[model samples]
Target: MAWRKLDKMIRPASCRAGCWRCVYGCPYGAKWTARDFIIEACRDGAHLADRARVLRVLVENGRAAGVEVEVQGKVHAVRAPVVVLAAGGLGSPRLLHASGLGPRCSPFFSDPVVAVMGSVDDIDGGAEVPMAAGLSLHEEGIALADLTLPQPMYAAFAAQVGRVDRLFAHKRTLSMMVKIRDEIGGGVGPRWADKTLADSDRKKLAHGVGMAKAILREAGAHHIFKSWHFAAHPGGSVRIGEGVDADLQTSTPGLYVCDASVIPEPWGLPPTLTLLCLGKRLGSSLAATRRAEGAA
Candidate 1:
C-alpha cells in the first residue's frame, strides 16, 4: 500500500517504498541479490571459487561422467558419478549444447528486469544496507530495489567520464535505481538478434523507473536518471521436463541442478531463497532415498 500510495503520490508518477530505485544496474554493490545466496550456499558447504569457469559437462555412455573446468588456463576434470548444472539460463544452455543436450533437452528460459536509475543527495550510495527496501505493486507482478555501485561499474554505466563526473560532481546527489520484473516480453536470445525487449517491457520499465524516481524524490532525492536494464538473471534452460525430471535429476541419471536457472517463474525479489529452498528439498529427498537403498 505504501508503494501504491507513493506511486499515486507521484501522480502521473510511481514510487515504491524503499524500493531502492535509488540505485540500479550495479552487480556487486546491489547487496543481497542472488549473489548473496550463492555466497551463503558456499558458506553452507556448496563449493565455489573465484575465477573458476566450467568448460563443459562430460557425458560418457549415456551417463553423467563428470565435468571439465578451466582454472588459470588449465583444464581440470572433476569426475563424479553425478553432475549438476546450477549455472544461469545462458550458462546452462551453453553447457548443455556443448555436451549435446542441445535444444531438445534445454528449453524454457526467462529474463525479467527493467532497470531504472536515480541520483540523490550525499547518500554515499554504496555505503548502506544495499537497497534493502522493496514493495510489491499488486497490479504489477514485480518488486523494486535501490542499489549502490563502485566507480568502475558506474563509469561503465555512465558510458563515459562526463557522466561519471556528473555523478561525482554532485557527490551528495547519489545515484539509485529500481529493477521491476518485466512482463513476459523481455528475454535473452542467442545474440543481439535474438535478444528482444518488447513494447510492454518498455512500458513496465517506464513504470518501474517512474516509481523509483518518485520514491527517491519523496525520500528527499533531488536528481534522477533512468536507462534500460535487461534481466541479467537468466533461468529455465535444461527445463525441469526436459534435461531433468521433476526431481531435478537430468536424463543422465545422477546428474542434478541446484540453482535459480531452473526456477519457472518471476521471483519478484532475489531468487536465493527459492534456490536454497530447492536445494534443501532436493538434498533431503536424495538423502532419504540413499538411506532407504543402503538399508535394503
Candidate 2:
C-alpha cells in the first residue's frame, strides 16, 4: 500500500507521523524475479516457448510426451513428443495431482520471510543494492534480510505508542528480516492454495523478529513495531530426489521442471541467482539434445 500512497498520501494518521508515502512493501524496487528470467529464456528460444502455461502433462504409454496449456484463457494442446514442467513450487504440485501422477507429493513450499520495521531518520539499509546485500544470519532453512517496504505503509508504525519514539530519535530504526528455509513438514493449513502461506510458520518467524528488534535496539532503534511479514521465495514441491529427479525431471520421462518449484528446501538466501544458473544448465542440455536429433 505504500507504493499506492506514494503520491496521494492516502491516510491521515500516516501524515501526522512524518513517515509519509514510501513503499516499504519491498524495500528493494527491483522486483525482478525468476519469472522475468524465464521470459528472457523463452525470448532467446524464440519459436520454442510458444508462451504457454501447461495445465496438464499429456502422458502416453508412460513416456510423457506433449502437454495441454491455457493461452489467453483458451486451453490449447500441443504435441511435442517431449515436455518440460517448470511451473515453480505452487503450480507444480497441482499439475501433478491433475495428471494423476503425484497424490502424496508434499506441498514443499517455502516463503518464510521475516518482516522488520523500526524508525530511522535516514534509513541507510534501504539504500543497499540488489535489494538485500547481506544476511543477518543463515541456516539450512532460514535467511534474514533488511526487507525494504515503502514509507507510506509505515503510517501505523509510528503509533506503536510506547518505547518506539526513541527509534526515530536514534535514526537507526530500519526493517530487517529472517526468512525461513525451513524443513518441509507440518503440512500447510487452509487458504494455502491462494497465498502459499501457513499459520504455524509464524512460530519460526518469531525468532527473526526477536533478533531484528534486538539488533535495532542495540543499533539505537526504539519505538518499533512488534509485527513482521514473511513472503517471496515459495517452492519445494516437486522436490528433487523426492518428488522429482536430480535433473529436475519427474518420474514421468521427458517431463522436466526448471524453476524454484523443483527446489526441495529453501536456500535461506536469494535463490533466484542459483535458480537462473540451473535453468541455464537445463536450457543448454535441452538445446544439445535437439541439435543432435536434427543432425541425426
Candidate 3:
C-alpha cells in the first residue's frame, strides 16, 4: 500500500482552540464546501431558492418539462426546457422514484467504514487534522487512513464498540480507518433506502482491520480495537447504463443526473473530485446542446 497525505484545505493555527468547527460547519470558511460554489453561482446571477424541496420531475409527452417543488410549505411548478438532478445519491433516486421514472433504485453501494484505534503512550491524537495520511489497496477494494476524530465522536465510536473504559483516551489514541468498497446490493425508495453488506465486503473489512492493527502495533499502540461499522458516500442508486446514458441524460430527453448517484459502480475512495468533474462535464454538454438548438 502506498501512503500519502490527503489533499485538504485547513489552517491548523485557526484550530488551536479545539472548537472542531471544521467538523460541523467551518465558521472561518477555512474548509471548502459546496457553499463556496453556491456563493459564486449567486454572484453570477444564478437564483438560489434556499429551503426549497423538489417533489417530482415534470415529464410531458415522455419528455423533460420541469419540476414540481415546495418552498415555504407552498407547492409550485417551475417550467424549464431542461432539468438536471444534482440532489446527490439519496435525494436523486428518491426524486426519480417519485417522478415515476426509475420505479425502484436497487443495488446501491455505501462504502462501509470502521476505525481501528489503539492507545499510545505520549502522543496527542484527537487534536490533529483527520485523515491526514492514508493508503489505498485498489485491488483489494480497501483504503486505510489516519484519522483523528473529535473527542465526542471518538467517545461515540468507543461506546459503540463497548469500549467505554477507553473513551477518555482520546488524547493518547492512535486511530486509522478501514473503508471497503462494498458490492452494490440495496434498494432505494422515495421514503426509505436499505443496504446490506455482502459476505465479500465483510471479509474485506476484516482484512483491512487486521492490517490497521498491525500498523498501529508497529507505531507503539496497544489495546487495539475497531469501532462499529459505518457507511460513507452512499451511491450507485441511479447508475450510468441502467438509469442514464453516456451524456448523463436519462430516458427522458433534456433531463440529466449529475451526482454521485450516476456513478456506475462501487467506488472505494471519496467521490468529491469525481462529482466535480461530472458536474463540469454535464454543464458543458448542456451548453453545447443549447447552442445547437439556438443555431437550428
Q: lDDT of each structure?
A: 0.59, 0.59, 0.87
Instruction: In candidate 3, list every pair of residues with a backbone clash.
Output: none
- Tens-digit lDDT track for model 1 on 1-296? 35421221121223333333334533334333456668877988978766888887888888889998999999999887768787766677667666776553333324455434455554654444344445666467556754555444554666542355445533344444455454332333333213355676557667767777777677776545554465555565555665567898877777787776566554445555667788789978877988988899
Between candidates 1 and 3, the TM-score winner: 3
- Candidate 3: segments with Cα more than 4 A from true spot: 9-19
Question: Best candidate, TM-score-wise?
Answer: 3
Error of 2 at 219 (Å): 2.9
Per-residue lDDT of candidate 3, residues 1-296 (tens digit): 58998887666555445554456667766666777888998999988988999999999988989999999999999999999998888888888888988776556888999999999998855766678789999999999998888889989999987998898998899999999999988777667778878899999999999999999999999989899888788888889998899899999987899998899998988899889989988888888978998999
> How are the candidates ranked when ordered by TM-score, highest leading?
3, 1, 2
- Give candidate 2 regions above 4 Å deviation: 1-45, 48-53, 121-130, 139-141, 152-173, 186-191, 194-204
Estimate, for each residue in 223-288, the C-alpha lDDT of model 2 and write its tens digit.
566543434666776777887788778888888888777776654555666787888888888889
Candidate of highest lDDT: 3
Worst 10 residues of 2 by lDDT: 1-10
What C-alpha lDDT does candidate 2 achieve relative to the native structure? 0.59
Candidate 1 stretches with Cα past 4 Å from truth are: 1-52, 71-77, 104-126, 160-165, 183-194
Clashes of each: 15, 27, 0
